[model samples]
Target: MTKPQKAIIIGAGPAGLAAALRLQQYNHISSVVYEIRPKPTTLGGAIGIPSNGLRLLHRLGLYDNIRLRAAETSNLVLHAIKGDVIGKADLTSWSRDKTGFGYLRIQRTSLMDVFYDAARLADIPIHFGKRLVGIVENSDGVTATFDDNTSDTADFLLGCDGIHSAVRKLYVDPNMTPEYSGVVNIFSLLETIMLPQARLSLDGLNATLTTDGLLALCPCTATNEMIYWFFSRQLSMPPGGGGRDGWEEKGKQEVENLKVTLLELLKDTSGEWGDMWKAIINQTNVVKFYPIFRMVLGGQWARGRCLILGDAAHAMQPHASQGVSMALEDVFLLSKLLEIPGRSLEEVYAVYEQKRRPRTDRMSKMAERNGNVRKKTGPWQLWLQECAISGMMSVYNLCRLDRLGIGQKELAYDVEEEEV
Candidate 1:
């Protein structure tokens, strides 16, 4: 078989777009992206791009643009519910000379803008309002059919769609479904002024650990203290919740109701000074509830020139905060594998899976552990958690181990320079 060139990329997300760009840049593979939404995703309020993700973005010539739009967060400050500082992972001396980046926080919309603009500048075509419904693969090529009843043929197809991937459902793993992790995250963006009048510094990524759960506030925009606040709580999906985020009018109303419920639930945390946590929630006009989901990712990543990447391949919890970084790692490694001369899609898929799956599996376990530690707990467990966080942060800071979020052993793996 000839080397696969023309590619069909499903989902214009960070992984998909980055895959397309990398494929074009390194392997000279041309691609067309199909996204279900009319425009970029508003999935969450903001995200933190670690060094691993940033390095890949830099290789794609997209680093500068994203850097300009995001805020640099050097400290992950841990705090108790009563507003006492416990510890912090100072990323200042995190060996920037090695990883070439620290931690960056940016709004989801801004990051999407960078990707979309970059795709446009690179002359890649992204077809919006197209939902994939069917896929057919033959010796000659693979064809992707959308809900519109139209189809496009390519040398191969990639399911960069998402966790709930149509490519995975229709073509790859038809019987599989996203398993609810019994954890839900409530998140929103806010101005610094919106916070209750408290003598607290908003310079670092502030994480408040309550007896119930965890709440985090990170500076997002580069110029100001526009905070991207999110909290984790144990909540069940209503047999089939998470239909969508609170975007539409009906969904917005549902979030508003959840907001009121959350206020009641967190009433115990209110103090004589004021309900600081409740005030932040009450002032937030746009609140979103996202239930964490995970996919069992032990099987094949490809079948007959069709493969999956990013969340479509392995969806984990958010405690690790490495979702986008891992997705970018997937994009980087896959494209690098494809660059090997005269390699068929099958060989490329094999090599890609061999090198990628173990890493993702390890990450999945790490995320689970992180989530468990951050869960709501009793006083003894909470005290243990506080000690654990402080101790770990102290270690990280003393060794300047923040060489990247997670450091040299993981974040330092630069696939661009590694042998493919």
Candidate 2:
């Protein structure tokens, strides 16, 4: 009798948990997930699980639970800062018929809860507070050492540790680091009652483009009572600032200053829009700020038996909204590759990179371009943005681009059958 290969997954986010579930379904492999956090907690704002991600969750039997807790977003509305409706992309029936799932927006906490529950039901052992200190990989397997000096050995290691991955530093490339994208984001969650008038206007996902930034308001719950809103602006770091660390250390003060700035910027918007921004500011109890960063496109995804996925491998701007979906796709591809018989771990790793890199690179470049468009700094650029958005809207309405496979290629991936 052959022993089942053991896999070690770092980080318990969507990618890691999904990987565990898929691997457990295979007869030849078993997995355990190690999360640094003591418990599952909300890390950031709401997330949009697009068709690609939703389809995979559906396969895992988690779609129904998440759907019940989240809002099914059917349309994306684009508006000018002055509150004039510029365009819209309707994705109601198109998503269902084309991709087998609809885009869902929910709080990060809600999503994590579902993943956690699913992991538990699958009997996957998740060790909390296991902060990775170092990883050593050889021909036979990989060993991970944690902060407490404990270690675990497994047939392979998957780094889902996110953008600041310690695994990447130890194994992949020591020189590679995240580059700041010259944009700062401030965001918060507000109750609908606080913005009563604004609630009346939010029939769907709403976004406004300004000369210096973009503001988006998305419903986070099915009842439409809680709203997730964010502002991303082109801001340069002050001289001698420590970048991300500095932002974190001074988060409170910076958030307050950002709130004031956001209120001032909202004044540029026409009537209800301006009032809505003010209401969101006044009603929020806590505000968070972070400087956006992106990894350089195209890197070695695997070194020996250790592999990195999700934000750890290809972090991108939020503009494309493919971050989570891309992460889900990575694990799906990996799970499929691992199921093939007579393949060495290295061979599987190589094929995974070959299949995933192109798609992720394309999305990263598109996200960068989208960020640039949103950061329009001049009248000419703003005018160009309006024209481009309007044209795309016209094309989308006529052709139903979402249904025409605009972002469905990743979603349509077929999972391999379980070994009988």
Candidate 3:
């Protein structure tokens, strides 16, 4: 009997967990996940699973379970900050017919829970509080060192450690760093009771565009009992603003200041929308702030037996809402490559990077462009955005662009019988 290949996955996020599950489907591979967090914590926001991502999860037989806790949306409603409807795009049947699944919005914590449960059932070991500190690779395998003064050896190492990946820093390329997008996002969750009027006004994923920035409110539950919202604005960094280590710590220290800034922005909005925004702000128990950052795509993804996937490989702006989807797609592709017989680890990593880079790079550029358009703050820019959105919605409706599922095609992956 052939010995099973040992794979070490860094980070227990969607990508890492999904990769572990996918590897389990193959008899030749055994994997474990290491998470830096001491325990599972609420991700505190919502994430959208587009048709492509939903379809992948469905194939893994986990979609039905997740669907029970998620909200399905049929359209995205664009509204002006003053409360006028700007445009709409149908996503229900159109997405299902095109990609074999509908779009879903669910709490990030819920999604992680589903993945975690599935991993547990599959008998995958996920070690918490294991912070990766260093990696050493040899011709036969790789050794991963954790901060706890322990080490693990595996035939391969996969980095799904997110945008601030330790694997990427210690192994792949130290010079590659995430670049700030000049926008800061403030996010909060509001219960339906807290913002009853806003809940009544939102029919689907609703967004408002203004000179200040974009405010998007997305329903997080099927019953519309809770809402997840975010306010993004172009913020100029103050001198010594983020400190030496960046905004992670600064964000915590300036929560009140951030709230004040957001409240002022809301005050500028008029009518019921303004009221809704204010209600959301007042009802929010905590307000979290983070600056958006994008990683430069198309660089080395692997060295020796170690490779990086997902945000570790191609972190992009969230405007396209493809971050998680792209990460899942990476898992699907990499798993397939790993199943190939007689291929060296280095060869598999090379092929994976060669095949995945172009697509991820393209998506990264598209996401950056989308972010730019959404972050417009001038009167002329806002007018142009309105016209562009209207035109795009018309084209989407007329040509049934949603049905095409253009960007989702390459993302679709089918596991082979032998791999399963």
TM-score of each: 0.89, 0.90, 0.90
Question: What pairs collide in candidate 2?
Answer: none
Per-residue alpha-carbon lDDT of candidate 3 for residues 295-382, written as tens digits (9 for 90 to 100) = 9765678988888989998999887778888887788888787766777777777787777777788878877876775464776777
Clashing residue pairs found in predicted model 1: none
Best-fitting candidate, scored by TM-score = 2
RMSD of 1: 3.5
Worst 10 contiguous positions by lDDT, candidate 1: 245-254
- Candidate 1 regions with alpha-carbon error over 4 angstroms: 196-200, 239-279, 395-408
| Root-mean-square deviation of Cα positions for candidate 2 versus the true structure, in angstroms | 3.0
- lDDT scores in order: 0.78, 0.79, 0.78
Output the lDDT of residue 34, model 1.
95
Question: Candidate 1 residues 1-420, lDDT tens each?
Answer: 677779999999988999888888888899999999987766869888777778778888989998888888766777765556778665534435567777789999999999999899999999999999889888899999988999999999999988989898888877767787867777898887777666144565877776656788787888755788887766545533545542244334547676665565455453522355666777788778676888875756788889999899988887766788888988888877776777788888888888888888888888787776546678777778778877887787777665544644565567666556
